[model samples]
Target: MRGEGSAASAAGGISGGDGGASGTVPPPRGGSRRGGSRRGGGPANRRGRRRVLRWVASVLSLLILGTGAAGYLYYRHLNGSIQTDALNLGETKLGGSKPNAFGQTPLNILIIGSDARNDAANQALGGATETFDGPPLADVQMLLHLSADRSNMSVVSMPRDTMLMMPKCTEANGTVHEASKGLVQTNESLSRGGPGCTVAAWTELTKIPIDHFMMIDFKGVVSMADAIGGVPVCVEQNVHSRTRDGKGSGLKLPAGTTNIQGEQALQWLRTRYGFEDGTDIGRTHAQHQYMNSMAREFRKNAKLTNPVKLNSLAQAAIEAMVVDPGLNKIDKLFDLSMELKKVPPGRITMTTMPWIYSTRPGLDGRVEPKAGEAEDLFRMVREDIALDGQGSGTPASAGSSPAPSASAPGTAGTAQSAPPAATAAAPAKIAVSVRNATGGKDGAQAKAKGRATEVATLLAGKGFTKAVADTQTGAEDTTVVRFATDRQAADAAALATALGLPASSVEKSGEVPGIVLYVGKDWRTGDAPPAPAPAPTKAPDSAHPLNGDNDKACMAIQPGFTW
Candidate 1:
């Protein structure tokens, strides 16, 4: 309920009236007054006019009643289709990140695509082969970010193989999980409790509060695609996916565009080996393309304006999803959609969490957070920064009202207002001191020893010759950079950029002697922070950039995937 009051109006609202233009009164022909001849005519003509009027009145009455009844029935049906789940992921604490200038805070939603094969039909879709009702892995996880002003949306997908420490979560049955100390696979969070647990894991990792979650199983994908009519996808070459043992998505398409729905849509999303490099990263890119195109299709088709299409879409989506109680209403979903649709396709972006191959032998083939780049992306979201540098707004009325800009992470303004001014001193010339506040005599880092010195060495290697370790220390949850004087603010900001720390983590401290850093538990092991993130206007090279309607873009097939 943190943002319930503003979620409706700030986000656009879709009126759910039946689609059609209102009937208009017609004018007389050739400047003649309507019914003038009938009025002047004899008794027979008058009688005829009276009969016609009666017939018209009767017909209009029936039409009105019929329309009202149909509309009510449809509304009830759509509402009934939705399934609700109490998001008993335990209490969520706000990260205290600043809202936009207008006092509107961002909304983060975790969408989970579960691989539960509970039914016979679902079992055929391919999942864990052992048991039908057994716990399932969260196959697809995407965090959708709605900007504070509702101007732009960013969908950040987390790979299933990525490892992270999950926060303790409470299940709907009143069971509680102790907070995990060791790094665990992210997908396991779902099995621990429910989709709420998945949300909790993310909250623990990013420190970003999640408002709600919408989860769907394998069958939901098929139903949703069918309801949306069809989503168009393209590929660069002919491909046929299959494995020697007959395990695969069974997807086959010629080297061009295809309108996929139902099973084909599921295949397109689930395909991995034939998509790009045959890794989860490659599959994630393909999913982004499908989603981007789907958004364009929804806008182009005008589902909200057409009652039939709208009802079908609403029913299909609702029936397919298990949502947090907060988002279980059709109106809420429509409002959320309208908010998202406000941003032009060009402004909406889809990116994956940066990751690296796991080195631990037991977890081989798995991936771990790429550290710097991943944190940088999360920080951008936490601050409500648009991925694209340009301001965002509704494409239909962008000329009339432009959206606020990505002035700085967690702020709004023109690009000119973004920080790290051109006159800031170079990194090498700026003095920096890092304190290992991860723990004390009996703390986690105490056993590791000399972590502050190690990080200082890492900083020195990055060209900050004056970088050194500090003696003062206390427990800190996240890493932060502080500067003593306003003059050194730019230098502190520069150092944060180099270390890939969020702009929110940089603060002014009058008591500090120089640019000082306190390395928190978040950075106990990394050699150095990730490279400075690209400006909002720029994207990391690894990201697959596509506008909402990138009709010309096509997925490239891997060598073995060629038909």
Candidate 2:
């Protein structure tokens, strides 16, 4: 009865405005029992059966009650075991335009999984210090997009290795760091300003608004998965993981679709060396699959509807979660749950930003946007467009400027524009250059040059009177459209669209002194537009072939369960 009351309070506070207080419900009257007893055969016979049945029922009820009580107590123990206050989720304003969906405002949630282990709670949760001895980086940074229509949702993973201008951040202990102190690593940003600073950094870099953030450490993830029984995940190949240091290792799973819970789930998510590429990208894709499978499994499990399981999950989430204080209450959590419940798994899409190794001088290993690629990706999110289909824009060239348009203010050559950078008194011509960067195919160079000329011609028509395509060996795979400054970059992006180039093929080259254009394999110079993709073949009972109609159930491990 207490457990039931607790469930009612928690759910009611979320569903209604009860403030999560306990309440008492009156017991049933005695007349109903008497009437049922009278309907039985004879008074003595009824009494005997009722007595035996009551005894058996009472024992069974007690056993069930005892199990529930034990489970609840165990959850309380787990909650007490965690250090919930170690990470301070600093204040973050909801930035960017409101997202459109289901009459409910779109929400951007920054989901962070930290590698912090300096504290005792973290250490107990199997968090260990790396030999490198740097502060914990964001092991996982995913931005969840709940669309305005509530018809779709997506998770965009921002790679830790991305090279970006990190905004100044104040640490938990009131330490301040500058964004302009040279290019900084993405994960280090989290260590500096906590989640707020990370959100700030993303906002500054991409100019998209973020709504909320939720972070969970290793312990929380493991325990949550365990509580959920297990998360179903599909593995394309066999995986065996062994840590060289031996602190965290020993994961072996046969290649196929399987339900992974607890330690096994953690291993699957954390394994980096097992993949062929062994890059974070591969690991990211794996995590995406794991998340999808988990969503599926959670939906399928009937036990999840049970009060015991629901209580366990809620308690675990509350204990392990370090969410924005605004979301600390049960009502807020329930509201979020209800809103998110409307979104089906089929509408949930996932992707990583298009990136390549950072080309900034001397930063060989780090990754950066391959020109305008990241910007375009961010813009797509801002616009709430589906990244998977034709709805997605083309990738811009590395370093291409933002598109100049009536929509974008303070852009180059606009009605209220600033003039291009000054040359000598003669007003030197800013010649545009293009080279065949797509590695050797006969006539490719000439074709690229011709296309470049055509693009230059388009630019000239748009008041870039002196634009001209360069004839040179631009055989590198990278197609960069450089601009002199923010204004010029904007101008170049606008011209790119009119020139019929994919936005991805155009990029702002921070290295280039002036506006330039680069093209990649995905682009072609032509007057006529390409045909749209054919519709997917529909199933007999389905009108939309690509519609994700079938529900795929999955499970996630609860926080405390062992592998």
Candidate 3:
């Protein structure tokens, strides 16, 4: 047995009995030397030695097993540290994503950062004693999307100042938050019912099924960053974020790559005052750089296999995390991390949603989603398309035949290849549903405001007196005419003809009612739709995609913030 060696060896080699160094150590090349010891000679002494060796083995095995039991108990302790609640607290439950052709579905998790100072550690990190015990705001929100093949990942960050209609949510304590009648600040949803409410708001807006959520506070960020060792960040110039009154992120860094963690990492992520343009948009970009650099350096260090480092991450996460029911267990969390590990750093892309300053009342300082571009970004995630542009995933173009587009409204579509121009019957007495689809693509012009009603009115000027305009949005790129039944085919063609659309645009559908006129993006302001180009697969240029492997990139510092 391994423990038959010196006492020092016995203590060191007590891991297992599976042929490991700790398991067995061969006797000095052969059987114990006879007469080598003064008390040794024949079978009696040999038998005694054998008994001692067996006893040592037994003792070593017992020690190893006991240590394993302790480790198991610690694992249980870790599990108990984690808290869980519902995945979605919205009364109107959202649906899940369908599996791909290979029976693989994507995993979407929302990572939330709360500006909460409920405890001593948090108050120290956030430094707002007057605001302690107040409703927390989600200062940071990122949706992490793992592709169906686990080959790529995409992150979408929503600025805290965004304004939207938050859905109805109920807390675990049975407090019901009614849906907003007017647009509300996106970050306020966190105070309604915890991170679950935030998750509900995101799912309702993006319509992307979220599988789980993880929420952390200021203190949590510091502890987790400490466990990650350090993440390297770069600045274009030496800069400090604080003003004379000490109102800022308090970040100060030299113009170069520096491996930062703990408090410094937190500052770097929150340093909007020192970054370019000195706005929340700039802070969002800085956060992207930190996240990407951490993702890259974490794998390069290969710390996941190190037991001490692994334990540090686990302990940090457990102490400062509140997750959904699906990830309440340690083993489940490990499996999820494994899935993320399968993706290489280069395939990960992080972007902020395209946004514009809001003009809505009382929201002058806040932002709203930029109409066309924001929807395009959401479309990519909903369709499980990789944002890194290395994959060929494409959204179902909104400008398809009579069928409705699977993408969000206002997304530009291209003309579908279809039949030759057909003869039109009289346009009299035909009912048409005119819908505005001039919404997507990062175009210089915003959506045509009254395009649907304008088209409906145009149909009225023509012989089709029963045309109606609705608020329903379409993502079609080319204008099209859809008819539900065989009898309405001629009527649909007549309406298409009146709008100067080609016959290829008339499509027969089983789902549409009567006849519908989809005023696609191409026919936004014109009497006739123009010839369109192919549908775009890349995100709008405004998204500012940062790849994980881009280490040379540096944050641009503002002139006034320099030290």
Candidate 4:
């Protein structure tokens, strides 16, 4: 099939190498099939299943050791089960990355939780019961960021309901899905061109190079949870999932912690109707907590040392995922997992992308990326800087020096390059016009009460006596210090120094009088702009910082979900 050929090409493996039972390049054992054996459940069938299990267990033992001494014995069987898909359109078509000081490149993988009921097992899991096979939704999307040195890991979630532009993508069959000039729900990318299109949407939005992707379906989720034994979750109060009218997830649990597995685990992940805020954002928090616990469990379980457990997990994980060709090999996945293991859980941080509720007509309840805030995150990731201050010796935390813009190097937070007149202006003599340009897609400003006046007041306290709040607020992509003429360039430079903006951002507008300090989304709420000088050793506070190992908090049950 065309799909199989595309997948095989993606894995970078030899063509026609070890095809699997599904008529695909790499097929899984019969036991990995969704339902029981196609043949009768006789004594011979039972014996066959036992032999396969035992053979798998022996192969896993050798793999966990990493010596590859006996790899040839099971390499074909394991490799054949993997399914690969195209990773990206092209690094050139999509902007690529920047290596760290060590010359090691960072890895960014898009983890997709696909709700694709393409067969009987998936259909039984639930969603639009009328059809046997339905279009897939990339419902739970998380971008897993691994630092170049593997010192830290960060996972950032994008809400499924976020409305954004999806770039044009080509499917396996050579059919191209055109870009939506207007906004569409982020999850729609999956149905358009499989998981590859979803990766394209992220690259377009963040401009961060996506190395690869791994997609799992409804059955995959259940199988994975079972293989891991169970994961721990918590709630602040007694919660019941089902609604009064029967539109709930059918999950009910008492207050405090619970070790949930299988169907119960699926419910915990899919119970958005009765969780905190009853929204996807709340569900994202729950997922982070679950992932953190799962990591801890893996560390504690020592599955690699136990042949049975290791084989079970390895088999389940392989059967559950469709990954990029680069990661299609058993050794490749093992190596990646080892790299991830190097980072301690305490160094891992999980956060949701900054976004605002949408008010666009017919798009109510959806969200759009919060412009300046989201870019700050994307820049950090692209530059290979750690959000938690634990990556390499160079920390990209709150107070770290901001990266210089690609267009203008050595302009970030440096005062030596400022214009002469900028040094001559006294603090009290610096007249500034503070404009609040933190408005929305429409003309509506953020409901932040008197934000312009507040910022101007802050400037006044800093000795800019003439700093007055502008009556009009507009939408701006980047914060800037603009001057009306070239004569005022020095003054703009001085103001940029005060606001920690790069000198490249200062420009002569030939319109606004004095220094027009257009406050973008970056400093919308802060009392003062980030200082240009070296930040204190202490880390800067992030918007929604989630510490993986240290957090033990439970979900606060919503009013409706409470029993």
Q: How accurate is candidate 1 locally (lDDT)?
A: 0.59
Candidate 4 Cα lDDT to native = 0.58
lDDT (CA) per prediction? 0.59, 0.46, 0.62, 0.58
Q: After superposition, how far is residue 430 of candidate 1 from its true place, in Å?
A: 34
Q: How high is each candidate's TM-score?
A: 0.64, 0.53, 0.63, 0.62
lDDT at 11, model 1: 19
Per residue, candidate 2 scores C-alpha lDDT tens digits across 404-432 of 22111112113222224323221124456
Kindly report which residue pairs in candidate 4 clash with one another. Answer: 10-325, 11-325, 20-27, 26-80, 27-80
Clash count for each candidate, listed in order shown: 2, 51, 6, 5
Clashes by residue pair, model 3: 398-476, 399-476, 410-439, 410-440, 411-440, 413-477
Better candidate by TM-score, 2 or 4: 4
- Over 4 Å off, model 1: 1-73, 76-81, 86-92, 95-98, 119-129, 303-313, 392-436, 439-537
lDDT string for model 4 (55-163, tens) is: 1122122223232223323443577788888875421123233444334456787888765657665554442443344566676677878876567877777877778
User: Judged by lDDT, which candidate is best?
Assistant: 3
By TM-score, highest first, what's the ranking?
A: 1, 3, 4, 2
RMSD of each candidate relative to the true structure: 21.4, 20.8, 22.0, 15.4
Once fitted onto the true fold, the runs of candidate 4 whose alpha carbons sit more than 4 angstroms away are 1-76, 90-92, 303-305, 390-543
